[model samples]
Target: MTQLKAGDPAPNFSAKDEQGNTISLGDYKGKKLVVFFYPKASTPGCTVEACNLNDNFERFQSLGYEILGVSADSAKRQSNFKTKYGFQYPLLADEDKAVIEAFGVWGPKKFMGKEYDGIHRTTFVIDEKGVIENVITKVKTKDHTAQILAD
Candidate 1:
């Protein structure tokens, strides 16, 4: 994986959200953004991470950060996950993998001794100027909000 780092320009992307509404990096211009990618929607680890963020949504917002989740799932699936968890943020249905590849979070991953190509669970913190402020690779799903706000 070509991990993005602080000081690097976040790769811009346009994709459809769970609601089938178009969303783009440009829409969040001049705002802090948290774009997180999960391997799949509604999975165990993904659920913990998303719920943690949702539970602390106001904290992030008060700090001027907008949260967005991304995964290579269909719009319906993304919508289901969001509605089920009552997440206040939008979940990007990056079915085309455009946003995933743009961020270079797609690569080989091993689970239970099975190796396959998939989206790596990652989070990117983008500053108001559209530059990356932090990249969380070793994510603690149950405590992701703390990790993002740690800086």
Candidate 2:
């Protein structure tokens, strides 16, 4: 897997949103994008991150940034999570792990003293010109939005 870094062009992809709409990187070509990859839907840490993003949705919008959350969860699960949390942004279903692999966020993880392969909680901030502006690899779930916005 090629690890992406700041100043690199973000790997482009098209994924289905919660509402089953096709959203592609090209669609947001001229806009700043916050594309976050998390392990699962509705989990404790994931929930905190998602909710924090939702709560600060407007602020991101005001800054002309679009938010997108991607996971290996099924479309149904993503839809349910978005509805339950009242999220204003799109939560994409990457069950095939294509986009995850493309972004190099799928890999081994350690949780509770056990090692396993899973999605890394990472966020990529793509600038308006489609270049990666910043990468938040060690994401703090609770203060995720603030951390990204501060970038």
Candidate 3:
């Protein structure tokens, strides 16, 4: 995977959110952003990571950070996951993997001795100017917010 790093310019992207509303990176201009890419919606690790961020939504907002979740799932799936968990932030339905590829999180992964190409669970912290400030590859699902904050 061509992992993005601090000091890199975040790729510009536009995609439909879980609600089927158009969302673009431009929408968050001049604001600190946290773009997290999860493998699949409603899955075990994904759920914990998303819920942890949701539970600490206000904390991020208070710190001037806008959070966004991304995945290569269909809009319906994304919507269902968000509704079921009552996530406050928008989850992008990157069905085409456009956003996923732009962030360079699509690559090989291993699970239980099986290897396959998939979306890697990654998070990017972008500054107000759209430059990456941090990239978290080893994520702690239950304590993701803490990790981001600690960065």
State each model's CA lDDT, in order: 0.95, 0.92, 0.94
Q: C-alpha displacement of 142 in model 2, angstroms?
A: 1.2
The residue-by-residue lDDT of candidate 2 on 32-131, one tens digit each, is 9999999999999999999999999999999999999999999999999999999999999998898999999988878899999999999999999999
Predicted candidate 1 versus true structure: per-residue lDDT over 1-151, tens digit per residue: 7568899999989999999999998999989999999999989999999999999999999999999999999999999999999999999999999999999999999999999999999999999999999999989999999999999
List ranges where model 2 is wrong by over 4 Å.
none
Model 3, 1-151: lDDT tens digits are 6567899999999999989899988999999999999999999999999999999999999999999999999999999999999999999999999999999999989999999999989999999999999999989999999999996
Error (Å) of candidate 3 at residue 140 is 0.5
The order by descending TM-score is 1, 3, 2
Candidate 3 vs. truth: CA RMSD?
A: 0.7
Q: Regarding TM-score, does 1 or 3 come out ahead? A: 1
Instruction: Enumerate clash totals for all models, in the order shown.
Output: 0, 0, 0
- Candidate 3 runs further than 4 Å off: none
Better of 2 and 3 by lDDT: 3
Mark the 10 consecutive residues where model 2 has the least summed lDDT.
Answer: 1-10
Worst 10 residues of 1 by lDDT: 1-10
Q: Could you tell me how far off, in angstroms, the CA of residue 108 lies in candidate 3 after the best superposition?
A: 0.9
